[model samples]
Target: MPANIVAQARGIVKSFGGEKPALGGVDLAVTPGKVTGLVGPDGAGKTTLIRILAGLMTPDAGEVSILGGSPAQRLDSIGYMPQRFGLYEDLTVRQNLLLYAELRGLPRDAQEAVFKRLLDFTDLARFQSRPAGKLSGGMKQKLGLACALVSTPPLLLLDEPGVGVDPISRRELWAMVAELTKEGIGVLWSTAYLDEAELCDSVYLLSEGELLFSGPPADLTGAIADRVISVTGFADRRRLALTKALDRDDVIDGTLQGRAIRLLIGEGHPVPDAAALDLGPDTKVAPTPARFEDGFIEKLGGGPEGTSKLAAAYREIPPSDAPAIEAKGLTRVFGAFTAAKDVSFTVPRGQAFGLLGPNGAGKSTTFKMLCGLLTPTSGTGSVAGFDLRRSAAQARSSLGYMAQKFSLYGDLSVGQNLDFFAGAYDLSGGDAREAIERVTQIFELEQHYKRNAGTLPLGFKQRLALACAVMHQPSVLFLDEPTSGVDPVMRREFWTHINGLVRRGVTVLVTTHFMDEAEYCDQVTLIYRSRQIASGPPDALKAQAGALTGAADPTMEDAFIALIDASDANRDEEAEAA
Candidate 1:
């Protein structure tokens, strides 16, 4: 073993039921005093590899070691946070931290000091007394991270720690990871977000249980240096059509961003002749720095294949004339507490509208009302041309909904679940069969149709949920954090389906903690403290957020932080002036 290596795996192999190989001859190494990121799309064996390293599961074959010892035997020296961090929601934040501290065998005095430091680092001091169940999604993620950090182990394994966390919270968590690495704690972080890979000192790119690339982020880009270009005017139909027409070559890997497309061309590949394409005279093409996303997509062989049709189809949906979904003076109060106040918004037909806010910002409450699952305390609303309060069933009939958790029956087969949903929507016999077949193909669920739902992987479960939701071909779709625990590749695939649905005139209303996902929406409504604060396209929001943070080229993450910070500063100023 290398002297600085904290953990090492050689030729690891794992299989389930002797047929499905989860990890195939995988090799990984985690060094001490650095953050090593494992980046890959869903079903890429990230979680399986992490589990093997954490000693939670045994690999079918391979050598695994931690701190120069077998991970199973040296489990006490490592801290593991699985995708689901086994948090006891019933416990208070303090209690949860204390429980983990004790389990890790810290003395009372040491536990107190560690607990205080973790709470301060996670910024949960104000919510120490709150039940873990009551914490917002971001806060819960912080709490999970805090619990994992309680023992302060030298080797930390985190599986998608920032999956469903807000940008601010994600930043804080990464900061904590950096701090730990500085203290000589080895961290193996698994994430689907390519942006997060940039923060790591080293990264291992995994796909289909194979290691594609492993090195520093800088090295990854340097290897493909000067091969990326930013092409503007992608929003123009003619230009977009031309770009897609030329995308069949293996040399080009293009990804759309708003009105622009970032094309990753192979080294020495000739640039397209702008004049030949009839692109506008003002069409601007410039070399742009390669982001982690670009590098990952390029390495993965030109973004996901067979997804362009979905993208193009979604773009064809006409903007709604009347609001496909709307809330008018919607208010939800619990005794003396008000969850939502006068929240009103109009989601145009076929548009991808997003509702974003901190946990408990009344997003879920508003979503429930929009879905007709919960009636507003005082307000009138309509969805799909049906009154939310009086014609909920009619409204529901036109909408498809996927909840945060995998809500399908565990004991049933995937085909059975789909059949049940189809029948519930009143599609029978041949119609139901056709709907099932279409959705199965769309989600690539044909192979897993006969498999038990409970035995599927996280990504598969998410796919199944989406498949079920769309089985009825509803005109509107409501997704509540649908990609929360999915891997990046799977996340991209999921969005491809969403875009396809939208292009076919299906309105989508989604709420999510991932800020990057927020960028994909046609319009966004940002809620804070039960009130709508900012609403617009992501670019508009970014321009509106000026000079409030670290960099001038503020990303959606940076913009969100700045917006929230500015709101708080204004509140503080008002309080002082009073």
Candidate 2:
């Protein structure tokens, strides 16, 4: 091993059973003083590999090393932040950081210095005394990072650290990581976001537990030289039609971007005939540099990439004429605290409506009220025309809900859980059996059907939760952070399943922290501080926010951050004036 090498794994092979192999002969190396990204979709074995390196789990066959020693023997030299960092919400930010610092056996003076620097970097200095549970999703993520950095281990491994964090917080976290790298701490960061992969000094692309490519991001782009083109001017409808038409050709890979599309053609492949297109005269086509996403697509067979089949499925619900859910002047109060105040929204039939906000911005409270789990202190609402306040059960029966946590019977097998959910929905005999079979096959759960839910991986558990929520095939579906902590591959697959459900005419009301996932929604409602700050298509919201930031083209994340920051500034100024 090289002198700078902090972690190394050779010929790693892990299997859950005799049939399915999760990681196959994978070789990886992480160098000190650099950030190495482990990028892949869900079920790509990112977590499994990271777990092995962290000494949290053992590989069936592999040679693993950390800090020039065996991983198991050098556990104290590494700090790992799992997808779910197992944070204790009840603790204050300072308390959490202090606890982790103590666990790492840091000296009192050193711990204080580290804690102070972390607070400054994470911008959590003012919120140190606040309960972590009360912090926003983004803030919680910052705390998680702070806790991980408490000891300043030589090797830091992070698994999807930005999964549910807002754009501002995500950027801040990346900045911290970059600073750590400069300090000569070897960092291995795993994420599904291709855009994030570009920030790493080097990347290891994994697919279905197999290494697809390992090199600098620039090298990956160079491999697909001169193949990417950006085309604009087709509405989503025409874009979809065109994508389908172009997808028929084996040599092309296309992905939708706002009102435009990016196409990557195989080397020497003929370009599509422009005259054959139904494009407007304003349509513009230009060569564009291959991005990390482009490189990922090329490695993954270059199809219209973003979220996978599951993502598309989750995003594809048909348009609805009838109001599936309606909340009029909804308000929720806990003593002197007002969680949601005068929040109102309506979801048309078969539409995918998104609820977005900071962690304590009342998004979850509103979601619970809409689902009939929490009665609003003041308001009138209905789901599938059933009164939300008075007829909670009736409204709930017409809707399916999947909470943030994967809430399934851990002791039961996947099949047993599906059966239980089917029974809960009142499906019987053949109907229950058929529903179970269909969902299992669709989600590719057959391989793990007999496995206990507790024993399954995070992605599989998420799939099972989704399957259970939709077993009765309710007209309306409510998903709360369904993609949280999921790997990129699995997230894509999960969205594909969701899109399929939407095609069958299910109305989806989803609350998620993933800004990219917001784009997949037909319409989005941004809830900030118990109020609707913005509502519209992703493009429109982005455009409006772009007008303020002076960015000609603002991404969803950019728009969201701009809007929130602007809102907070306005609030602060108002308070000062008062």
For each candidate, the alpha-carbon lDDT, in order, equals 0.80, 0.80
Q: Candidate 2 lDDT, tens digit per residue, 1-578? A: 78879899999999877456889989999998999999987778899999999998888997998876887788778988888757889999999999998888888878778888999988999999999988887788888888888877899999888887756767888888888888999999998777889989999999888999999999998877687776776554533433353445533455445556666767666555444444565566777778777678767764533223443334334555778889899999999989999988888886678898876889889999998888899998899889986788888888888988878999999999998899888899998988888788767899999999998877889989988998777889999999887755456555555554555567789988778777768788888888888888888999988888999878888878888888889999999999
Off by over 4 Å in 2: 1-3, 10-22, 55-67, 71-76, 88-91, 130-135, 225-256, 261-268, 274-289, 302-321, 487-490, 496-504
TM-score of each: 0.91, 0.87
The candidate that achieves the highest TM-score relative to the unseen native structure: 1
lDDT of 1 by residue, 34-100 (tens): 9999998777889999999998899989999898899878978898887875799999999999898
Q: Find the 10 residues in a row with the least total lDDT in model 2.
A: 304-313
Where is model 1 more than 4 Å wrong at Cα?
18-20, 234-247, 250-253, 266-268, 276-282, 305-320, 547-552
lDDT, model 1: 0.80
User: Cα miss at 476, model 1 (Å)?
Assistant: 1.6
State residue 569's C-alpha deviation in candidate 2, in Å: 1.9
